[model samples]
Target chain A: MKRSLPLAIVFIGGVVFFISYFVPHYISEEILQRQIMVEWIKVISLFAFVIGLYSLIHLHVNKIKRKVDNWQYSILTLSGIGVMFIVGILLPEKFNGGIQQGSIYDWIFMNLQVPLQATMFSLLAFYITSAAFRAFKARSVEATCLLLAAVVVMLGRVPLGETIRSITQGFLDFPKWTQWILDVPNTATKRAIMLGVALGMMATSLKIILGIERSWLGGSE
Target chain B: MKKFFLNIVNLDRRWIFLMVAIVVSVPLFIPSNPPIVPARPVQELYDFIDALPEGSTIMVCFDYSPDSLAELNPMGRAICRHAFSKDINVIGMAFAWPSGSGLGQEVVSSAAKEYDKVQGKDWVYFGYKVGFAQMIIGMGKDIVKTVQADYRGESLKNMELFQEVKNYDDVSIVIVLAAGGTVQTYIYFVNTMYNRPVSAGVTAVMAADYYPYLQTGQLIGLLNGMKGAADYEKLINIKGLGTRGIPSQNWAHIMIIILIVVGNIAYLLEKKQTK
Candidate 1:
């Protein structure tokens, strides 16, 4: 009964949304999409987010209790969340408590979070350089072609490509060539991949709707 | 000669890292504007926005977070600056992440301040909300029903902006400045579903993926990374962060190219000796 109930719900919901797409009349437009789908999705997402937060906190608390390896990092994570919650939610608005602009929460986000994330992403430059220098070799024809394309694209995206064009007076146009590569071959490849992905998504969604994919129900009874 | 080639091929990555650091940093101190010719896609975006009527509204979705601030923040600011300078109403929103709301607020509010545009009159920000797909669809049907308030928790019912701009039909174009797949989401749900004109300013890494969409006319125009932002900055005649960051990018590209060439030559030499 438990399993059948959830499967019945999924089937009904999926079929309704599918039919809603075809029928753009008052029932589908007003009730199904505008009222039901939007509110239900928001409510579901809110509950899922609460579950996620609880899971994270519970996992970290367990780690701390068990004195696991790198438990110190869990403490840092919990402290950060705790501090933000306290300052942003628990305190009064006069104390700069809300998660609005000009609050202490905003300051932490802009000053601490922004720079930290940026710094972490910036390290990719160093690693990518090292990787390219060592890994990009022309052992085969395919490797050579890839290497050349990479070089051309890199040059064309930069000011150096324009410099070359000016120096050669439009005789050598790496930027134009780069644009062709992107507009042609890159697009062709991306489109093919996108089509495949879309088809796969459709199949999986159908399977879920038909109750053939019961993984979403968490576990077997 | 073989030993020298071998050493070149096997040089420690730390040395390469150091060289990269040097190349990237040294150009910033030089302070020279390398020639920037705006690409066709970027120019189209500029032209479209330029041709908008003074009171026409454009929705700029900040679909990125702080990690992409260097690339996307400039694009957001530039679009806002361009729109505000032209007396066009700008509606800022985010459907990607909660952090995107903060970024959108920063970009729109700063540019709004510069142009002395009133919040409810000239602009409104319907900040980040959960459930992106449903929210986007709901906004298409009725925006006020989907979003109840502004980012600051102020009621949107009283906002003058909402009186004129209600749904996708009211928006001239939807520009998504993204670091992730939100551009595709917008393209699918908003553009394909509602037939709204859509464009994107994406990171350099993600730019190539969208050229097909550009060809299909699904995207009206595209801003490809810092260069695209730089191009827009040039069009606006305001040398912002994008322009300032270009020389460093130029030097870095040159350095990488040189390394690729040197590495390839050394590799070939080693192959010949082995043969």
Candidate 2:
């Protein structure tokens, strides 16, 4: 009974929401029910964020109390959080008027988070490059095709290709060729992924609506 | 000595990180000149905005943070500029978070001000509605209910701009400037429900996943990452963030290429020596 309650909510809400997309008459009822369910989800999710905040606080506070190794880092992490929370609550919404100042949160987010995240994302460039160099070996025709496609995309996207295109040797338009690579092969890959995602999402939604899948609620049994 | 050097080449990942860091970062301060190729996806995106009828309602959904601003913000600026130029009524909001509303308002209003447009008279922000997907669905019914107040807690009823807009249809074009799940959620709720032709400015990681939606005509257009932003800037004849970042991207891409080539050569040579 305990497990079924959430499963029931998921099933009903999921089904009604999905169905109301087609049938216009039951739309108002569908929307009202969905809103109520969503509000409940928001309240729960906000609490979840609190739990995360609490965990963050606990981990750092515990390190300080225990005087663990490198406990200095904990102070930095804890204070950053405390400062942001305090400022977000206290700031006059108008100092940020016209522009959502984001204020200190914006400041921290731009300076600290953007660079850190960009660093992580930029690492993918070297990884992809090396992976392509090794894995893009031309052992077969298909392998050769993949190699050629990778090469074309890599070169066509750069300044060298534009410089070459300027010399009028009639090699081919890099921009046009790049478009084909993205619009054709990339599109094909995307479509295949989409088909798979569509199937998976459909099945998953069906399961939720049918009360078959409930791991999301933590142990349906 | 060659053998020892090659052995060290295969030795540690830290060396590679150091090499990559210097390759990508040092060129940031140095001046560089690299040709940027405009793309069709971005052009199509610009053209869509160009084609929108004057005073058409455009929903600018700020679903990303500054972390994604490197890639997403340029396109955001371009699109905002385009919307304001056409006198498109922007109903701004952030489905993502409290921070999102602020960031979005800044970008959207920045463009509006450039065109000498009035805030509440020409465009108004619905601000942020809390429940991500639920927020989408709520805006589908009544935007005011989900967002009774702007980010500043001003009642939506007081805003003259949103007076006629009862639901989703009131929003003619919905564009998501995001780097994360915000686009996906908008696709599911906005696209799936009202068949809203939601466009997006997304990061490169998420770009590949969107082609399927594009093929199905789920999203009318897409501007993918910095490259997409640059392309849009070119098409619009605006020189901004995307244009400025070009030289650095070029040098970075070259370094990445060289590293890949060298890394592979080392791997092959090591294999051959072992054999």
Candidate 3:
């Protein structure tokens, strides 16, 4: 019953959505599109987020209880979530209307969350340099060609690239060359890969619809 | 010579990091105006916006979060500035990420203020919706039904900016600034399903991956990363933060190139010695 019910649900739900896309009648348009997919999906997503929150707190709380490695950091995570929740709930109605213009939520988001996220992202620059220095070797013919192409692209995508071209009286316009590289060869390869990915996605979706892909159901069941 | 090559190959990664820091930071302290030449993609974006008739409304979707603000925020600001300057109405919203709405609100509000454009008239921000692809489908059918309120929790039913905008038919164009796969969702649902004109601003890393969309005319134009943002700034004659950051970007790219070249040279020398 456990397996059969989920498979039945998946097949029914997938077929309904798939059919609704093709048939544009009011039943499909209003009921399926507006009422179910838009409204019901959003409500379900909120519940999913609540479940995720509970899962996170439960996992971290257990880790602290067991005094696992780096369990202290879990306290910080819980504290951050708790403090943000408290602040969001305690704000006046005016500030709580939405996390918009003048809200304390916006303040915390801008000052704390934005900077922390940006700093984590900016660390990519340092790592990219180190990785490139260690790994980007012109060891073979293809490797040499890749290295040259990389140099051209790196130079051509910036302001200094144009300056170099003007200094050479437009004879060495890396920017123009860069545009051609991106427009021609890059587009060709990307299109090929995109076709492969699209086919793969179709196959996976069909598998799920047919109940062949039961991995998403989780566990031995 | 062999020993020197070995030493070069084995140098501490910290030294490379320090050098990169110096290269990137030096440009900031000693600022110089670096000439920005608009690439074909950036020029197309500028020309597309410039050609929009007065009073036409466009939808700008902030599909990214704070993690990509450095690359995308400038593009958002430049596009908003251009649209507002051209007297075009903007209906801003976020569909994929939650943080996107907050960031979108900040960008739209600040840009609106700079141009003396009032909210609910010149532009409206419909914060965020939970469903990404479904929201796009709903928006294509009826925006009001999909997004009921603005970022400030005000109803969008009678708003002037959205009075004529019922769906993708009323909106002239849609620009998605994204750091994730949401741009593809926009392409699939909004562009393919409704035949609406779509453009995108994405980080440099993801720019190459979207070239096919641009080539096939699925994406009308693109702003690729901070350099693209800087290009838009130049096109608008603003020389804002994007333009200012170009020198640092240039230096950083040059440093990476130098490292690659030196590293390759060291590898070759070491191979020769080993042989």
DockQ of each: 0.84, 0.39, 0.81
- Cα displacement (angstroms), candidate 1, residue A71, comes to 1.7
lDDT of 2 by residue, B2-36 (tens): 56546645545655656666766776778765667
| Least accurate 10 contiguous residues by lDDT in model 2 chain B | B4-13
CA shift of B206, model 1, Å: 1.1
DockQ winner, 2 or 3: 3
Tens-digit per-residue lDDT, B98-186, candidate 3? 88888998898899999999888889988887777778888888888788888777888988877888899988899999999878988
**lDDT (Cα atoms) of all candidates against the true structure:** 0.91, 0.72, 0.88
Over the true interface, candidate 2 deviates by an RMSD, in Å, of: 3.6
Say which prediction, candidate 1 or candidate 2, comes out ahead on TM-score.
Answer: 1
At residue A61, give the lDDT of candidate 1. Answer: 100
10 residues in a row with least lDDT, candidate 3 chain B: B1-10
Tens-place lDDT per residue, model 2, A140-206, is 7886677667666666666666876887664766656876777778899878777898799889878
Arrange candidates by TM-score, descending. 1, 3, 2
**Per-residue CA lDDT of candidate 1, range A1-221, in tens?**
88999999999999999999889799999999988899787888888889999999999999999999999999999999999999889988899988889999989999998999888998999999988888899989988888888888998888889889999998879899898899998899999998999899999999999999999888778
Task: Give fnat (model 1).
Answer: 0.83
Model 1: TM-score, first chain: 0.95
Clashing pairs in 2: none
Where does candidate 3 clash, by residue pair? Answer: none
